[model samples]
Target: MKLIETIPENFEVQIQKITGDNFLKEKLESLGLYKGIKIKIIKNNKVDPLLVKVDNRRVSISKGLGLKIFVELL
Candidate 1:
């Protein structure tokens, strides 16, 4: 598994685990991020906010939050 922030743009990955507090987990879940879900990295330049496609919705997330999301290549 690798941190979501490290994933290259245009790559699709499966969410494996999310490491953080309940509030953080809930926040991510509300944005359509959860374990077992597949997400496509739309932008991960390391300078701007990470953009990802989840369930057909495009969501932008901070790199800090992406650090807590573990994913595997799909």
Candidate 2:
């Protein structure tokens, strides 16, 4: 598994785990990020927050937090 922030745009990944404490995990889960969910990288420019498609909605995730989301390429 790799960090979500490292994947290029237009790639899809399946969440394997979110590495963090319950508070962090809960925050991510509330944004539709969790194990078994499919995530698409829409934009990931180093300067700006990452843009991702989750649960059919577009969401921006910080590079710092994105690194905590572990996934496998699909």
Candidate 3:
């Protein structure tokens, strides 16, 4: 598994774990992010918010949040 922040753009991955508090987990879940969900990285330039597609919806997440999300390449 690797931090979502470190994955290259266009890579598809399945969420494995979220290393953060309940508030963070809840926040992510509200955005359609949760364990076992497949997400595709639309953009990851390292200088801008990460853009990801989840269940046909596009979501922009911060680098900090990305660091807390562990995923396996798909």
Candidate 4:
């Protein structure tokens, strides 16, 4: 399932394990995504950036990263 499909508030899901270059993984981690961490899709930004909340901080998810992140609603 896509990450954006998850309901807001008290959401938790493991990020789809992905294999990529070290640079890419580090970049993703910097955006607050890891194997066991849960993220919340706080709000949708169709034309602009996709806003998300992780570790109680708001972070923006780009279109490319959004598509790569597969998550199940829990």
Global lDDT scores for all candidate models: 0.92, 0.89, 0.94, 0.65
Candidate 2, superposed: residue stretches over 4 Å from native: none
Q: Please report how far candidate 4 places residue 20 from its true position, in Å.
A: 5.2
TM-score of each: 0.94, 0.91, 0.95, 0.66
Candidate 4, 54: how far from true, in Å?
0.8
For residues 2-64, could you state the per-residue lDDT of candidate 3 as single tens digits? 999989989999999998889988999999999999999999995999999998999999888
For candidate 2, the per-residue lDDT at 36 reads 96
Tell me how far candidate 1 lies from the true structure as C-alpha RMSD in angstroms.
0.8
Off by over 4 Å in 1: none
Hey, what RMSD does candidate 4 come out at? 3.1
lDDT of 1 by residue, 1-74 (tens): 99998889999999999998999899999988999999999998958999999988999988788889999999
- Stretches off by above 4 angstroms in model 3 are none
Model 4 pairs whose backbones collide: none
In model 2, residue pairs whose N, Cα or C atoms come closer than 3 Å (at least 3 residues apart or on different chains), thus clashing, are none
Candidate 1 vs candidate 2: which has greater TM-score? Answer: 1
Best by lDDT: 3
Give lDDT: candidate 1, residue 28.
Answer: 90
